[model samples]
Target: MSGTRATADLAARYRVAVEADDPRVLIPLYDPGALLDVHVPHWRFQVEGRRPIAEQVCVLPRPGRFTTFDGEATRDGLLVRFEWRQNGPTGDALVRQLHAWRLRDGRITEHLVFCAGVWDRELQQRMAVEAPLVRP
Candidate 1:
C-alpha cells in the first residue's frame, strides 16, 4: 500500500482503539520505545516507551466519553482532532484536542497531543461544523 493509505489505515485503527478504551488494543499500535508528548494549556510532559504510553491510554476518559474523532493522513503521520465530553459536579463539560502521530514500520514512533483547554458549548458547536468528524 502507499504511505498515505497505510497511515490512513493506521489512523482508523487508532481511533478504534481510543473509542474502545482498551489499552491492550492501543498498545500494539506503538513502537516499543515510542514517545508521547502531551501539551495542554497548562501542562506539558513526555512519556517514553510503550509501557508508559499504555498506562496513559488506560487512564483516559472511557469510551463514549469522546463524542467525535476526525482524522487525516499527513505526509509523515496522522492528524486527529477529537472532542470529548465529561459529566462533573458542575455539569457536562467538553474538551477538544488535536493529536499528531508519526508512524514507522506501521507503528507509532511519536505522538503529540495539543489542547488549549476545556471548550465552551459555542466553540464546540463551531468546531463541529467547521471540522466535522470523518472516519477513515
Candidate 2:
C-alpha cells in the first residue's frame, strides 16, 4: 500500500479503535515488527513488536469516552490530536494529546505520543476558577 493509503487507513483505524474500545482493530493496524515509543513525565515505554504494543493498549483501563479532533495526515504519516475525558473513580480528568504516526506499507511501523498533561499547574489553576468541584 502507498503512504497515502496507509495514512487514510490510520485515521479510520483510530476511529474504530476508540469507538469500539476494542484493541482488536488496533492491533492489526500496525506492522508485525512495529515499535511504539511513549513518553510521559514519569514513565517511558519503548515497546517493540506489534503484539506487545497491542497487549499493552488492551490492558489500558477504560475510564470514559475518548474524543479525537484536529487530525491531519500526510504522505509520510498521520497526526491525530484530541482530548480525552476520563471519568476515574475519584473524578473526571481531561487530557489532550497529539499522536504522531509513521506508516509503512499500509501499516503503522512507528508511533510517538506527545501528551499535553491535563493535571498541569496551569490547568489546575484554571480549573479551580472554572470548575472547582472537579479540580484536583
lDDT of 2 by residue, 29-104 (tens): 8899888888766777789887677665443325656654656776577888776766677566677667788877
Clashes of each: 0, 0
Off by over 4 Å in 1: 87-90, 119-136
Q: What C-alpha lDDT do the candidate models reach, one value each? A: 0.78, 0.70
What is candidate 2's CA lDDT for residue 62?
50
Question: Over the stretch 41-71, how does candidate 1's per-residue lDDT look in tens digits?
Answer: 8799999988789678545533237788778
For model 2, the stretches where C-alpha displacement exceeds 4 angstroms are 1-6, 58-61, 118-136
Candidate 1 is scored at a TM of 0.75
Instruction: Look at candidate 2 and give me any clashing residue pairs.
Output: none
Please give the RMSD to the true structure for each candidate, in Å. Answer: 5.2, 4.9
Best-fitting candidate, measured by lDDT? Answer: 1
TM-score, per-candidate, Cα-based: 0.75, 0.74
